[model samples]
Target: MKKNYVVMDGNTAAAYSAYAFTEVAAIYPITPSSPMAEKVDEWSAKGKKNLFGSTVDVIQMQSEAGAAGTCHGSLQAGALTTTFTSSQGLMLMIPAMYAMGGQFLPSVMHIASRVVTSNHHSIFGDHTDFMTCRMTGYAMLMSSCPQEAMDLAAVAHLSAISGRYAFMHCFDGFRTSHEMQRIEALDYEDLRGLVDQEALQAFRRQSLNPEHPTNRGNNVNPDIYFQCKEGANVKANSLPDTVQHYMDEINKLTGRDYKLFNYYGAPDAEEVIVVMCSASETVKETVDYLNAQGRKVGMVQIHLYRPFSVSHFAAAIPATCKRIAVLDRNKETGSVGEPVYLDVVTALNQAGRGDIRVVGGRYGLSSKDTTPGQIVAVYDNLEKDEPKNNFTIGINDDVTFTSLDYKEIELPHPGQISCKLWGLGGDGTVGANKNAISTIGFVGGKYAQAYFSYDTMKSGGLTQSHLRFGDEPIRSTYLVSSADFVACHAPTYVSKYDLTEDLKEGGTFLLNCPWT
Candidate 1:
C-alpha cells in the first residue's frame, strides 16, 4: 500500500474496478459515461482476465436499454454482468432495473450521473438522473472523486455478490468522470478478498439452468403476488448491513474508513452541512478553514444514499449541531426542496431530532461552479437568526433573489503547481495533460489531478484542460481559478477564450503556436 498511484479519470478508475469483478459487460456509448464502457471493451479485446480467470465478454449493444437487457439476461444466466451509462441512457435502463431488482440479481452498473434533459439538453454534471432512480431498488453508492469512484466501485461490485442486489455506483457526470487524479489503486488480489466465494457459488446456483429445470419470470395472480413479493423483504431489508460489511472489509485493505455516512469537522461542531459527491470534498476544505479559525462547523457526507438509514445519518451529526444545511446538486423546482434536503428533513423527523433545524440548498446544476466562498456563505447563514432556507450558489439570481452574496474565495493554493491549457477539441491537450500528470504523479511521488471541459460540438468545440501537481492530496474540487501557469494549446483559442484569465500576477503564459 506504499504507492500504487494511477493517473486516470473517475470513469477509467470505475471501469478498471468493475473489470476485475465483471464476467460480462453490456456496453453502449454516451457522453461522459462512454469512456467507462469503451475501456471495458478495450480490456476485453486485449484478453484481460477478471477474477474468474477469463477475459470478460464485452458486448456492444444497440442502445442503453438494450445494454441493460443484455446485462439482465447475462445475470440471469449466471454471468456476473455490468454496464456504464448516464442521463437519458440511465432513464432507458429503468424498465430492466425493475426486473433485475425483483430477481435480486447481482449486477453492477457504473454511472456518471448527468442532468436530466428538461428544456435544456446540456451534457453537464448533475444528480437529476440519479435522483430518479431512488425507487429502482439499486444499491446507490456515490464516489466523491476519481479515487473514491474506484474504491467504491469495488464496493459496489462486491456488494452485488454479497447483497444480491443491483448497484448504481455513481459519480458526477463529466466532473469526476473525466477528471484525472493520482490515486492508490485497489490491487485485484486485495479486492479478491472482498469477493465472497460462498456467495458467488450461491449466486451461480440461483441462475437459470436447463439442468436444474426451475421456473422464473412467472406471472403470479393478485391473490398470491403480494405474499410472494413480500418474501423478498428479508434480503431487501438486510442489504444496507450487507453493504456496510463489505465496506468494513475494504477498510481493512485500504485503511481508509468508509461508512454509510462520514463526518468531517470539529468533534463539537455546531454548524453542520449535509451533502455528497464532489462538493462534499470542497466543503471539507471550507470546514477545515472554519475549524482552524475556532468556528464550529462540520459536514456529513452521505455515501450510501439509498436505503435512507435515518439512524445512521443522524448519528454522524454532532449533538452540538443546531443548524443544518443540506446542499443538493440537482434541483427540484416545484418541490419544497432538493432531494437530499427533503430526505434529511424526513430523516431528522424519523431520528426524532426535529429540534435540529435542517434546510436544503441547491448548487452545481449543469456543472455550475461550487467554490469555497459560496460554501462559506452557507456556513455564514447558519449562524444567522434566520438562514435562507432554500438557496442557490455560484449565481447571482437578482430577479428571483435566491442566491447568497459571499466574498470571492479561492482554495488556499498550497504547494500545488496549477496550470490551465486552452485548446480546440481537435487538439491533443487533454491527452497531453493526462500523460503529464501520470508521469509527474507516478514518477516524482507527487499527487496530481486533471479536469477538462468543452462545448457540445464534439470535434470542433472549445476545450480547456486544468492540471494540478502537488506533494499532498488535491482537494480543490472546483476548476483552476488562479493557475500558476497558463498555456494556449491551440492558436485559435487565443482569440476565443481568456487563456490567461486567472494566471497569477507573475505567472508564465506559453502559447503553443508556431508564431509564438
Candidate 2:
C-alpha cells in the first residue's frame, strides 16, 4: 500500500530521502541548504537506520573540500555515500568530483541550487552553483517539486550504483527547498528491489581484497593515457540511457511520467518556453492559462541538464514554435547568452530550424521573486511581435533597459479554492504554506499547487504565497491572477500597490495586522 506524509519544505523532504538510502553522509552547512544537513544530523542522532539495514555514519567536516574528500573515500570503500551542499560549497567539491568520475565512483550529491555570490553575498536559490559543476563529468538531473525530488533522488542513486557515475540531483533552493507540500512517501522495499544486486556484488568483489592480490590505481604513461581517457569517456556517454531506463521503470510503478526533456502543453503549439528546475512549474501554469484563452503556447521542462540531449530537446519542441523564450536563473557576464539559452538556440539551429526567433532572459537570481505577472509579460511580448534579444524580468530597467512593458491583467477565473498569504521574511508564512500543502497531499482527491514571490531589496520587501487545491492537477501557470482569497501580512503593502487587483468579487481577504 502507498503511504502519504507531509513535509514542511524541499530541504526537509530531501533530507528525509537522503537519510533513508544513504549509508554514509558527509556534509558542510551553507545557507538555504543548511537545513538539509541539519535534518540528516537530527535523524542520525535519533538512531534511525537507513534502507541498507545499517546506521548512517554522519561526517561533519571543516569545509566543503573536506566533505567531498570524505565522500570520495567512503564511495571507494564500496559504501553508498551521499552529500548535501550549495553555492561555494558546491564549487569546493568540483576537484574531487572530477576525480570521482574518473575513477567511476558511485555516489550522489543533493544540491539545493543557490547563487554564486558576486558584488555582494546572497544566500538564495539559483542555478549558478549547479551550472559550475556541469564540466566535472557528473550526471545532472533537476527536480521541479518535492514529489519529483523524492522519486528522482532514488533514480539518481540507482543509476549511479549501476552506471558507476556520480549524480548531482538539484532543485531550486528556498523556492522548492523551503516550500512545503504533501507527497506519497516512497516504499523502501521497492527501492531495494530496483538496485542491481549483481553489479553491487561485483563492486564489492572488486574492492581492495588481500585474497585477489590485484594492483589498482597504477600510474599510466603517455602511451596508454589517451586511450584510457577515451575509454572512460565512452563509458560516461552511455550513462544517460541507463539513467532513462530506471526512470521509465519508476514512472510505470508510480503512474508519473518522466524523461530527459519532458514536454507539457499542446503538442503543436506555436510558441514555447524552455526552462529547467522549479520555475518550470510556474511556466506550465502560465502556458495553461494562455492556452485556455485560445493562445497556442506550450513548455519544455529540461530535467537532464549535463548531458544536454540535443536530439531529445529538438524532438520535444514543436516545429511550429516560432517564438521561444529561454529563461535562465544564472547569468553569464560578458557572454553572448546564458548557458541554457545558448544550448537551446544551438540545438534548434543544428536541427535546421534556424527560422525560430530565440530570446534569452535572466530572472529570480538570489531568489528574487518570479510571479505569474512577470511570466504573462513574456507571453504578452510574444503576442506583440516585439521580442527583445536579452531581457530581464521582475525589475524596472531604467538604464540599459531590455524589459518588456507589462501591465497586470486579471485572470478570468479566480481558480478553485485559491488561497493567498502575506508574511514577513522570517515570520514563517512560507513555512506554513508548505505544511498546509503537505496536509493536502495526505488528503485524497486533491491536487495542490503553490507559488511564492519576494521583492529584490531584502528589508521591507514583500512576500506572498499563491496556493490552489482542486480535484484535477492545476495546469494554470503564471500566478493567481484571479485570487478568491487574499491574505495581507504587511497591511502597509495595501497602501503601496493594488493588492486586490486580482481579487474576485465576493472573495475573502484576510489581513494580519494590528487593530489600528
Candidate 3:
C-alpha cells in the first residue's frame, strides 16, 4: 500500500495535525514546543488551508498565559483553537485550562513535555510539566514517538470536538520533540471526513454571539456550586469511548491499530511493566529481547492518560500476570507514588485484581537515558519476593539504596545501520545528518530516525548525533551504544573524548584531520 510518508520531528508532526483542525492558534515560544508553534505560524503565513478551507489565524502572544487566554476566548467564540507550550508555560496556562474545562470547550493544547524547573532550570524532556495539570479537567493523551505525536494529536482534537471537553496532547520534549523520523502523513481530506460536523455546528450555535446573546461565566452560590460541577460527570465518563472512537477512525485511515492502553509481548505473561510516552518504545524492545529468551515479560503502553479508563486498562493486562512494575518519568515529593503508578494501583483495585503484586519506580527524569539494561532491572525487581516500591532506575542512588542492580544487555537489529557523529553543538553536523536521514527515509524509501544530544552550553558544547536506517521501524530510543559507523567532524575531538568507544568491533571510523 502506498503512504504519503514525510520526515519530521515530533513538534512538526503535532503542528501538522493541529493545523488541519485548528481555525486559530495562539502562540508563545518555549523550548522544544516552540517549533510546533513556529511551524503553524509559518504555514499560516504561506496561506496553508485547514480542513475548514481557510488559513489558520496565527496569533503570537506576549506570554504563555496570554496565549492560553487567546485560545480560551477563541474557543468560546466558536473557533477551533489550539496552542503549543511546555514546562513553565504549561504552569501559566492553569487558569485558562480550568476555564476551558468548566465551559466544556473543545480546545486542544499541544505540549512538548519537559522537566519543570524547581531548584534548578532544565529544558529537557520528562512528564514533570504534564503532571502538574492532571486536575485541571483537560483530558491527557500521550504519544510514544514522532508518528504517534501526529496520530494522537488528531485523536485529541477530534475527540475534544465531539466530547465537548479540552484535551492535552503531550509528547516527550527533546527526545521526541527534537528527534526526527519518517512518518505516514495525514491528509486534510482524510481528517475532514472523521470530524463530527454536527458536534461542531452545536458548538458554534452555543458560541457567544450577538444574535444569540447567551449569558455564561456567571457566579454561582455554594448551594449549587458542587452540584453544578457534577454536571460534567456524564461527559467525563464517556470521554474514553469518545477518544476510542476517534482512534479507531484514525486506525481505519492510517492502517495502524491504537487503543487506550496498548499491550505488547507474551499473552500470558507473569511479569509486566507499565509505562507511558517515549520510554514505552525502549521497554517494548526489552520485552522482545526477554520474551525471545523465554521470559514471561510484557508491557502495557498507555496512550490515554486522562479520563483513565479502568476497564480498558484491566482488559489490557494479561490474567496470568502475577507481578507488575510501573515506571513514571516524574518525581513527586512526599507522595506515596507518582501519578501513573497511583492510577495503575487504583485501576487494579477497581477491577478486582488487587492480588497482583505491584511496584512503582521512577526513571528518565530530565531526559535521562532509559536503556534496555535499566528496563531489564525493573523486570528483575519484579521477580523478587517483595518488589521494592518507590524505587529508581538508570541511576546509582547510593544515598538511599533505592536503585536496582542491572546487567547491560545489547539487542541487535540485523537490518538496521546505526551511525554516530561527534561535533560542536552549533556546527552543521546535526543539520547535515538530519537532511541525510530525511533523504534516506523519504527518497530512498527506508525507515529512519535521527536524535541529537548536547550539553547545557549548547552552542560550543559537545553534540552527538545518532542516526539509524532500516527496512523496519526503528525502536532504539537511547543513545547509540554500539554504532556500525562513527564520524568525528571536529579535528580536536579525538584527544578530548573517547569518540570510538561506542563503535562496533568492525565499524568504520572517519575522522577529520588536516594531516589526513
Candidate 4:
C-alpha cells in the first residue's frame, strides 16, 4: 500500500484533519494555534471540500469567547463545528465549552496548548492551558508530535461524533505546533471511511431547528439539576472504548498502533515513567537509550486523558514495574502533585497496584525542554530506596532543593545529522530552517525535524533553531545539545552566547559577521 507523505508542521497537520470533518469553523487567532485556523480559512477560500462535499464556513470572531459562542451556535444548528485557541483564549471558552458538552455536541476544539499566564504572561507551550479544563466535561486527547497530531485529531473528531461528547485535541504549542516533519497525509476519503455516518445523522436530527422543536437549557432546580448532571455517567464511562475503536480504525489505515495508554521500552521493565503531551516523545527516546544499555525502564504515554480509565492505566504497566514516576508538564501551585501525578496515584490504588511505589515529578513548565538528561535523572531517582516525591527536573530549584541532579547527555541517532543556528527574533532564521526541513524531507528523501526556540519578546529576542535529518525516523524531541554543525546568523550572538559549546569536534562552523 502506497502512502501520501507530506512535509508539514503540527498546525497544518491538525488543520488538514480538522478540515476533512468540519463543516463550520469559528476562529479566534492565538499564537501557535492561529496557524491552524488560518490554514482552515485558507483552504476554505480555495474551495476545498470536506467529507460533507462542501466548503467549510469559516467565521473569524472578535474574541475566543465569541468564537466559542459561534461554535456552540453552529453545532446547535446541526453543523459540525471546530475552533482553534490556546492560553487565555481557551480560558475564555470555558463557559461555552460546558454548554456544548452538556448538550452532547460533537464540537472538536483544536488546542495548541500554551502556558496559561500566571503572574507573568508567556506565549510558549505547556499543559497548564488545557489541564485547567479537565472538569469542563470534555474528553481530552493529546499528541506528542506532528504525525500523532494529524492522526489522533481524526480520532478526536470521530469519537466526539460517535460518543456525543465534546473533544479537546491538544498538541504542545510551538514544540509540536511549529516543529516541521514529514508525515503520512490523511485524505478526506480516509476520514469519510472511518466516520460513523449514522451517528452523524443522528446528531443532525437532534439539532435545534423548528423541524426538531426540542427544548434545551431550561433553568433547573437543585432537585433535578444534580441528577441531570450525574446522568452523563454512562456516556463518560463509555468514552474510552469509543476513542479506542476509532484509534483501531486509524491503525488499520495507517498501520501505526495507538492506544489510550501507549507503552514503550522493555516489557518487563522495573522502572517506568508516565507522562503526557510532547514531553512523552523525549521520555520515549530516553527509555530506548536506557533499555539498550541493559537498564529495565519503560514509559507510558497518555492519549485520552479525560474519562480517566484506571483499567487501561493498569493494563499498560508491566508486572515487573516496582517504581513508577508520573511526570506532569504543568505545575499546580499548592497542590500535592500535579494533575497527571494525582491521576496515576488514584488509578494505581483503584486498580489494586498500590504495592508499586509511585513518585511525582514536574517538568517542562512554560515549555522548558525536558531532555534525555532530565529523563535519566527520573529513572535514577526511581532507583533509590526512598525516591524524591513532588520533585522537579530540567531546572535548578535552589530554594526548595527539589530538583534532581542531571548531567547533560545526548541520545545517539545513527546516520542523523544535527545542526543548530542562532539568530535574533524576527530575523527569518526560523523560516529558513522550516524551508530547509521541508526540502530535506521532500526533495532530499530524508526524514527531518526542526524546532525553533525563542523568548517572549516580540522582536530582537534571542532565537535558536535546532534541526536534524537522517535516513531513518527522528524521535529526538528535545533541543539539540550536540550538533555536527553550528551557525550564528547574528554577529552579536558570537560574543554573548557560547555558540560553539555543543558543536561536535571536527564539525563545521559557519559565522555570519561583518568583519573578517
Return the top candidate by lDDT. Answer: 3
How well does model 3 score by local distance difference test?
Answer: 0.93
Note the residue pairs that clash in candidate 3: none
State the lDDT of candidate 2 residue by residue for 1-516, as single tens digits.
465555445777777767777888898898678888888888888888788787788899999999999998888777889999999999999999988877888878999999888887787788999988877888898988877788888888888888878889999987787665556667777777888888777777766656776776788999999998888767767877888888997897688899888999887887788888888887877777788888888889998877777777888988778888899999888999999999999988998889988888988888776766788888767666677878988888899896766666544443367877776666678767766765675554467767666655534567778787766655443357667788888767778878787687999887788877
Instruction: List the candidate 2 regions with Cα displacement exceeding 4 Å.
Output: 1-8, 208-226, 352-355, 380-386, 410-415, 420-446, 449-468, 474-516
Query: What's the distance in Å from true for residue 170, model 4?
Result: 0.9
Estimate TM-scores for all models.
Answer: 0.97, 0.87, 0.99, 0.98
How high is the CA lDDT of each candidate model? 0.88, 0.80, 0.93, 0.92
Q: Model 3: residues >4 Å from true position, as ranges?
A: none
Question: Residue 249's C-alpha lDDT in candidate 1?
Answer: 84
Q: What is the per-residue lDDT of model 3 for residues 1-516, given as tens digits with 9 covering 90 to 100?
A: 358999999999999999999999999999879999999999989999999989999999999999999999999899999999999999999999999988899999999999999988998989999899998999999999999999999999999999989999999999999889999998878898889999999999989999879888998899999998898888889999999999999999989989999999999999999999999999999999999999999999999999999999999999999999999999999898999999999999999999999899999999999999999999988988888999999899999998988877779798899999998889899989999999999999999999999787889988999999999998888999889999999989878899889999999999977874
* lDDT, model 1: 0.88
Q: Write the per-residue lDDT of candidate 4 for residues 474-501, one digit (tens) a residue.
A: 8888898889999999998776888999
Per-residue lDDT of 1-516 in model 1, one digit per residue for the tens?
A: 555777888999999999999999998898889999889889888988898899989899899999999999999899999999999999999999989977889989998989989988989999999899888878799999998999899999998898888888989988899988888888988887678899899999988899997878988899999997889778777888888888888888888999999999999998999989999899999999889889999999999998777878989989988999999988877998888898899989889899998777889999998889999999998899888988888899999899989896776757889998887787777777778888998888888988888778957787888889998888888888898999887787667676777899999999877882
Cα RMSD (angstroms) for every candidate in the order listed? 1.5, 3.5, 1.0, 1.1
Error of 3 at 154 (Å): 0.6
In Å, residue 433's CA in model 4 sits off its true spot by 1.6
